[model samples]
Target: MDEESRNGGPDSRQFDVSGAKINILSDEYDPTVSLISSNEKWVEDDEVPRKEVGTSSFWQATSNTVALLLGTGMLALPYAVMLGGWSSLALLAFFAIMFCYTGCLLGSCMKENPLLTTYQEIAGSALGLRGRILFTIFFYVEVLANRVGFLISVGDNLARIFPGVESHIPAWIHLSPSMTLASLAMLLISPTALIRDLSNIAYLSFGGIVTSLVVVGAVAWTGTTVVGFNQPIPFANFGKWRFILGLYSYCYAGHPVVPNIHSSMREPSKFPVMLMLSFTIATTTYAGIGLMGASMFGKETLSQITLNIPRDLMAATIVLWTTVLTPLTKFPLAVAPIATELESFLPFDSHSTAHYVFGNIIRLGILGLILAVTITFPYFGSTLNFIGSSITIITCIILPCVFDLVLHWRTIPKLQLMVDIVFLTAATCFAIVGTFSSGGV
Candidate 1:
């Protein structure tokens, strides 16, 4: 490859499958980099000028990372355990550790080239323009699918909270109560998508973390007092192992945003520490809720633990409301990176009045697209299963390892290279089997 192609310079712009020009190095226009070279060499840890890099504190970044990981998928861990039996918790822990390691690999890639601010840039830097485009497509689909699952969760929980809501909908509308509620939620969250800064949403992300803990606590309280955890959970059930793997994979669907969170940190070198802390917290929460809910309602646990809680109990009310609130806070964080990338394609200066005018239009268009998909295929469990099996596995488990191996091939130890190859092979197999299994769901 030529020097420009090797470095993924701006002149390397190419057309995607959809016939749209995608500039993989579009960050060149970012004001933050006006004084810095895009091709600068990796700096030493102590050599990085932390005061010039970012604005977010360590805890704020931690909160954002936690919120991103512990989304609608966490609520389904109990159902995953039910499907795969008691042995599945082991798979969950294994995935948590492997994904955390891969996440740190991504942080290392960013550290290798501090100018790479997005996941696509990392891909382009390592594997060239095609890799960048492919990763972009996979990452965007995962985010959109997660948003769809969020709407589906909101619809299901809202319908459960008001059992008579379907009957109240007009016959002419031909919409189910869950669909109506999801539509309303789409409208409610549309405004937040317009926010340009991640720092502004930190508190909202923290709210998501708080609400997740409340839901977990409520599930525990209900399981102990109301449901009586005396049910028999099977030791192993390999019949649905494919679907179970997908569910576990979906729980770690936070890798795409890791780059964004890393970029937002004031001390980006500590990103590995942030990843370890966030994954530890998320894994612990998933395990606690999964064990408790599955034991209490083994073979009968709903896709969302909140769905299994007794409707008449106070714990159920708290769990239901908190579940509803969790997605609202997270919707913006999930879509912001996608929005920024889409806006970069506009034919105007990044700070021009024309860009501002058309940017809000683009954001609204994204919301409209998400709303349409959510309404058409509103099956919560099946939608999540398909996405987790197919897209989530690729983005969260497979690609990070591939990118890291490509970027650090020569310098990485022989054993570490073997480990990345093993992970890549296993994740690919699981993704294929799980996709085929969950595709029929």
Candidate 2:
């Protein structure tokens, strides 16, 4: 290949894909020069630097990473375990470890070539232009669907909180609990979505973490006390384990964003430490919340653990409010990527008034479509399953392992290659089986 094609030219930006740095010079194709040179633009435009004066400290990065990992997924764990049984914990543990490992692989790719900023960029690097396009398509579909799921979640919680309102609202108004909450959510998110700077909404990301903690804490306490854990502690039946494993895997759906998070770290080498700490905390919390809810409520455990709890007004209010507010805060951040990508295609100066006006209109239109989807088909489980089977597995497991092997084929040890093959095969199988089990396929 010509130098320009190999190095990605001047416009080519690289971010760290692998957690560890790779010495690409030894290879027939030298990736180091292009990777390093292209990173300059990304470093300048990255959200982290715009949000703050400098790269984030370990703790700051940790907080954000943890917040990203901990979310509405926690609420569904109990139901996952209820379906997969206790065996699901083993699957959860396995997936968590693999998730972190694959994350490290992405990090290593970044380390080798710190310029690769987005998942799409990394995919492009690994599999060339085709890979980039494929990843972007999946990324858009997965995230849009996820956003719809978030709307559904917010609406569901709101319905629970105000069960009476749904009854009172006229049928002619077509204001079911789901529709009403989704409409309100879209309204709340529109203004935030219009803004160009993601840094402005940094504070809102914490809402997911705070709300998650409250829900987990409430579930743990209530599970032990009011519910009186009469259900089996380590309940296991392998029959429907695939279904449960799929949901559990869905909980660790933070891999796509890891490179961005890693790039923002002040100490990039320590990114693995940050990854482990965040995953450990998130996984433990998920386990505790899921197990407790399942042990207490048993077969009765609902998709959201809070729903199964003895209805104390205060608890219900707090849980439900957080559910709404958490996603409320996350809506902008979640949709920002989509808006940014869509905005890029418009032929207008980003700084121009026309751009801002048009951008917001497009963003609102996107949100309107998502809201419509939620209203039309408000099934959260199917969305979760689809994401888990498709993007989650591809981004988290298959792509990472495959990229590592492909990028460093000659240098990496045979044993490591074998392991990657095993993991890739197994994870692919899981994705397929999980999809079928979850009725996604």
Candidate 3:
């Protein structure tokens, strides 16, 4: 049930700020909230109807956040650790702390401007329409590319399950790995993609987290028992250190979804605790997987840790297929924001049949586009690198720090402002070097 329905009318408010209540009858309502003028500013926006009503809890939010951060990104960590050597482990820990800082900035921004639920909204509020446009362009590029990468993974693993299953067909079939896998991805992800209410799919997100844990456990077991240890790489490879920063940045790529998860929680203030819990679990999993995979396989670690598993082992197949399933579950939630942002621009009645019809149309259209990209260029690692270097940096480190500085420029202490400036400078340099290195230029 929606907040309005539960509260008996649009006039009812979930949070009381300044003893004022704003009524938001529907999703189409404008989000204009009155702000408190005091030092500790607060937003009282009623139009941004409570997401998930009473169903969303702290643990659910944490699990979903884990599900988002723990997918495909972790798969590449073993390779990232290999690239940067053992020092990459230290870098991962340091970045995890930095990530938590930026995440809190995002949360604080959302609290100050409660009307802002989406990144585009936050960008527009801070930097105007052009900023919104800039953020939107970058967001869609990153999201679509990430989804395409997921589809490619699905296709590749499905092909692996039935090796030579394609060759049994006649000559005219002409099914390459990309083609076969792309078709399979569409078939697998379409049902989840059609889900409009993200709260309903929370279980799927929970399952994804569990699946990732299983995969991690399986990889750790295989890395310890089955895989033979080889001479380890150096502590840090200065030559390719840029690539490690980008890949590790990708491994912590959950900042973009902070607002969405924050908005869904029963109490937004608890978001920081949730973020801390989720990131702790995520970093532990990442360090263990990366260190174990790199230590066992050494220089021969594949880009995906699962690939290092001996194929004949049942654990290998399970991890491969779980890798496929986790992404399929995550693809929908990742793309929902893009669809929601697009829908706000079109002329469709929220209560009419056209809105329902058109919403699915947009969702399916996105799936179709991802499928086409997977078929056209099924390369996954390069795509991952590009996303890590480009949008991931923007959403994770750069934008949040910039936004916080702009939002609290005068209110925050000079020391805090200087710290943000330092963060922005360091992250920007990291992004630039990572981008160039990832492109092999």
Candidate 4:
């Protein structure tokens, strides 16, 4: 049963925040409470208890975030190798440090301000509401585009393997239509329903992690046979470490989800450990698969390439469909929040939850935009690099630390600013290089 049907009324929970009853409601329990002034903060006043952080569990959270990213992009890992060769691992290590650093800083902010749900809230706290909304919107736009590309790319691999139902339809129609339908169906469902609790889906994450290991293991076994350990390395402007850093940045963009995960964590301090483990797992996962792909396919074949390098159709199809499953699940959940936020201007009566969910055509419209972007910008590698680098640099890397330093400038020690300056400087360099390299210059 849904939260409404189960509770039979608005579900809420009261937290004593400075002697005020902060009644948080909804099945999703994502508190909509916002501070209007020092004397007033608005929270929904329903009789129902607040839903616990069940859907965003540590294992599942770790797995889903890692899996969705690893699936589509890890397929492109070989291309990174193709671009800069084995030495690229140096840049990868550098990014690992930065990833953990940013994750820790973001986590600290979340711990300090537990109510800060959106990165927009974090930004808005210092940069004003408009700035917060703009950055959040820009970040969401990139995420949506990336999600679309992920589905299309998965379809591309599936097409290479399945070929067709009857093997009679034209390539363009056959490919795009089926994938679009699959994406649409996934989006139309309520993520709130699919995962009422994370523990319910914890098995899915464990299953996904095992599947990833099996798939990558299979690839490693095959790739090792063909290319061995000593594959040819490229010298594509070796001096351009900045662009290389940008490429590595794309492979590790799950830092934003840290806040969502931290909110659920039993011992939030363990969050840094979890985040690091997640990144390490992701890095090793992608590097292994990328190495396998490059060993088997070489630079020319692997660039803008996919996971369809398998000779066995059955194996390839299974990997293609299953690898993208988590990303497919993430699409609707991520999109719903955007739609809900647009609820304020929605031309409908204020009190209809059904209308808010169903009446909005804007969600479908956003999906259409995603499809258009994937078709027009068919080259996935550079597009992924550029978007991932630029947006993540701003949203994940630069923004939080900047906000912390700026808003709490006087309270913060001088050492903190120096550290942020170094990171910001590094990120700027990476963004510049990533943009140019993505342009094929």
Q: Per-residue lDDT for 1-441 in model 2, tens only?
A: 234533444322222111111211111111231111112222235344221112667887677677767776788888888777866788899888889888888888878775565465678788998887777667667667777768888887877877787777766787677679678768876888776555455545445667888998777777655777689745676777766655777788867667767766667789899899988998999888887888888877777776676666467678878777777765665566566667767798867888888888888888898898888777676667666776788778998898898788988878878878988998999888877776631
Candidates ranked by lDDT, best first? 1, 2, 3, 4
Which candidate leads in TM-score? 2
Off by over 4 Å in 4: 1-71, 113-118, 164-211, 224-230, 235-246, 304-308, 324-326, 350-360
Better of 1 and 4 by TM-score: 1
**Model 3: which ten-residue window has the lowest total lDDT?**
13-22
Cα-based TM-score, every candidate? 0.80, 0.82, 0.77, 0.73
Per-residue alpha-carbon lDDT of candidate 1 for residues 210-262, written as tens digits (9 for 90 to 100): 67788888888887778888878888787878777778888888675577677
Clashing pairs in 1: none
Candidate 4 clashing pairs? 10-48, 11-48, 12-48, 12-49, 12-50, 54-198, 55-198
Clashing pairs in 3: 155-181
Q: For candidate 2, what is the TM-score?
A: 0.82
Q: Write the per-residue lDDT of candidate 4 for residues 300-415, one digit (tens) a residue.
A: 54443445345464555566566556455445444544554554466667567765565346666556566666666655666677775777666667776787776767877688
Q: How much lDDT does each candidate structure score?
A: 0.75, 0.70, 0.69, 0.56
Return the number of clashes found in candidate 4: 7
Q: In candidate 3, what are the lDDT values of residues 1-441, reduced to their tens digit? A: 254533434232111111111121221211121111111112235754333322357887777677667767787888888888877688788778778889888888878766676555677778887877776577667768777777777777777776776767567855685467668668776877777555455445445566778778888778667775554867888677776677778777756456656666776789899999988999999988888888888888777777777889989888888887767776776666566656555597766788878888887888888878777766666567767877788888899898888889889888878878888888898888877777541
Q: What is the lDDT of residue 369 in candidate 4?
A: 65
Decide which is better by TM-score, 2 or 3: 2
lDDT of 1 at 390: 90
